[model samples]
Target: MIVVVDSNFLQNPMLETYFNESATNKVVIIDYAAMEAFKGDTLTSVVKSTAILRRFPRQVLIAHGTKTVGRLTGTREEIAKAMINDEGTAEFREFSAHLDRYERGVRPDGVERQLLDTGRWATDHLNAAQAENANLLDVFKELTDGIFTKEEISKIRRGEQEEGWVAKGFGLVRDLASDLLSRHPDGSVKLDPKDYYNNFIFRMSLCVFVQLMDWIRVGSPSALKPARLLNDRVDAMFATYGTYFDDVLSLDKQMLRTFWETDAILRFVYAREHEK
Candidate 1:
């Protein structure tokens, strides 16, 4: 099994226990998790996390990989090291500069206003269309006819499953991903969607949320916390990508449950390839 770990779980203390418990699975680290580790206030603990990540037999993929001198280039340890000893590495310097910008809330094309904007856009459009006399809740039920039963829909509408239902798949969600979600199994859009099933279901959940917000006459978009938006997207990406692998490992209970749900959703939605 390919076990993907989250950023918050990259603590020095939990490494041995995690490895001991997952002695049989091939633990992997996604790029998002690695980049997040650089936020460590102490270089020692960050290095410790990177070292533990690299010890995995499988080379952890760094999608936004950095440059390092000599043969240590692009390794997890190198990424952390470059942050501390950037020296003259232009690539790592530029990357760290962006991190610096993010800390000051200047990340333009990043997660600065990621969830806030997305939730607004979704809620805005839904409200505008509802003003046109369209019943979107009916449309939502029609779209998720099989995935969520009618009883589940009623329960969610009653606010029972509202906690992590949106959060579970909210990270892999984007304007483009939602576009894919809206047009899926339709001939209107010619784009191909990502292979992860959570991507599809999460988008569906967003639509479900939009409907619920309007249905209950509640303003949920206004409730989205801007402070927690950054980490929300990060954790969302980890849980979303975890569906592509066999499993995800995380010390956080919420993230761990998301992993289980998304991975299980992937297998349930796609049988042959992911079936155990």
Candidate 2:
């Protein structure tokens, strides 16, 4: 089996023992920075050195970062607006035009190169996911408008007990965007939100984000959302990519709850055990 474990799992040394006993298993660890450190190393080497199961051969994969997938799916304008909320569309377009300068090492002095590098990487990934998932767009276009039966919403609220229900609900979520995209003068040219927003990693991140927002609204209506807390949640959202593997092992209750609510297909090892 393949498994995805949050980095926090490394704090518990006992977990390594369980993984070591299973030689056939593959494990993946997600992080915003881990991918850079393992740049030239083999997957096995990185896994053995950094992952929970050192004795086992390195059989791991890496999802790049929190916003990487999210930024990749939408229209250029949409992505820019999401990243720079205060900026007007024309202003963002002007900012994006500097990519060539940044690439040519013409960036202003004292600017953090890492941030620029990340931007470039995200841009590249966005193009790639678009090309790869382009065929899937038509599949999403067939979805009904944002409306769902009361029973469907009830099941979605109850969380992922049924197969296809979460996917159907996601179709509704995409409808919010699709409805707008459908208004183009060329009615045949509709962009499917899932084609961009619900790509493997982005979908998981969104699920966690939506669930967290719901909690924040209910738990502390007056509280200001802190930057660090939001960043932490984004970090945890990367764990959703664990669905690509066999199972996800996350310690954060919020992340676990979000995963459950989404009815993601991946198994949640710790959550299942905790229930008993």
Candidate 3:
């Protein structure tokens, strides 16, 4: 069992005694970022509290702040040294830039609009087709054998499961695009769909890339190839929906990448893997 040592607990002598004497020796010290969230009386006290917490085995203490949360096991010392020495590595710099962009609301070209528009279009088409004619339902029924139920459609309308539609449509579009790309003997990329759709690939690509970044941050290099392959499908998705929803599909891939890389789980995994 992992134990989280907050500044409050660290400052209290009794709590510290209990903590040290506890059968579970695993204790992780919360980092400055997380400590900042506390509405404490003084920063000095918090810092002292953190220092006391860190007196344990360096490998047992992890950092848990607002923006950064990772096990301190092995990576903590290196990470601390990097911060103290101001050695901002390329990846760290890139991650910082991504966060800056996100904070400023700087998004990809048209990704947001495309998602909204596609969602609206799907909703409208499904509604109109269902009400006026049985043909739409028949088509869906033929394809899914009633697996896609009316309740599911209703849930989608309520925004309960909108991702399901996006996932399904994206999968279909990606498959078709893949087939086309594979057939091209010259290897010259065909009239890609994003150009027509106004950069739908940008949005889809960002999502895929972010997913990959998250996987990497979690120290799961084994998943890298599959993640990259998923990213490659963004081009195909663009081809399928680029014409219909270009403006809404442009997304800032860089920001998403940064957010995932900085995620707590990624840092935790990194710490676990590098533990001595």
Worst 10 residues of 2 by lDDT: 80-89
Q: Best lDDT goes to which candidate? A: 2
The whole-model C-alpha lDDT of candidate 2 against the native structure comes to 0.45
- Report every candidate's CA lDDT: 0.44, 0.45, 0.36
Q: Please, what are the lDDT tens digits per residue for candidate 1 over residues 146-176?
A: 5444554455567675534444324323443
| lDDT (Cα, tens digit) per residue for candidate 2, span 1-276 | 656566545445655754666766655545433432233333322333344433342434444444443434454334422332222323323433443355457777644454445445644543454454444323333443244455654554555345565555445555534443444343423335335443434445446435534433354212423433444444445455543445566566665566554544222422554488
What is the Cα-based TM-score of model 3? 0.21
Model 3: per-residue Cα lDDT over 1-276, one tens digit each = 344333334555654464477556544433322223222333233335444344443224333221221111123234333222122223334433443454357756764454345445544543453354334224323433433355654554454636565455445434433443444444523334323112222223333433433333354334334334333333223221221211111233543333333233334434655594
Every candidate's CA RMSD:
13.3, 14.9, 20.6
Candidate 3 segments whose C-alpha is farther than 4 A from its true place: 22-24, 30-33, 37-43, 57-60, 64-276
Residue 233 shift from truth in candidate 1, angstroms: 1.2
Q: List ranges where model 2 is wrong by over 4 Å.
A: 33-54, 64-172, 175-198, 209-213, 220-224, 264-276
Ten contiguous residues with the weakest lDDT in model 3:
240-249
lDDT of 1 at 20: 57
TM-score, predicted candidate 2 vs. hidden true structure: 0.43
- Sort all candidates by lDDT, best to worst: 2, 1, 3
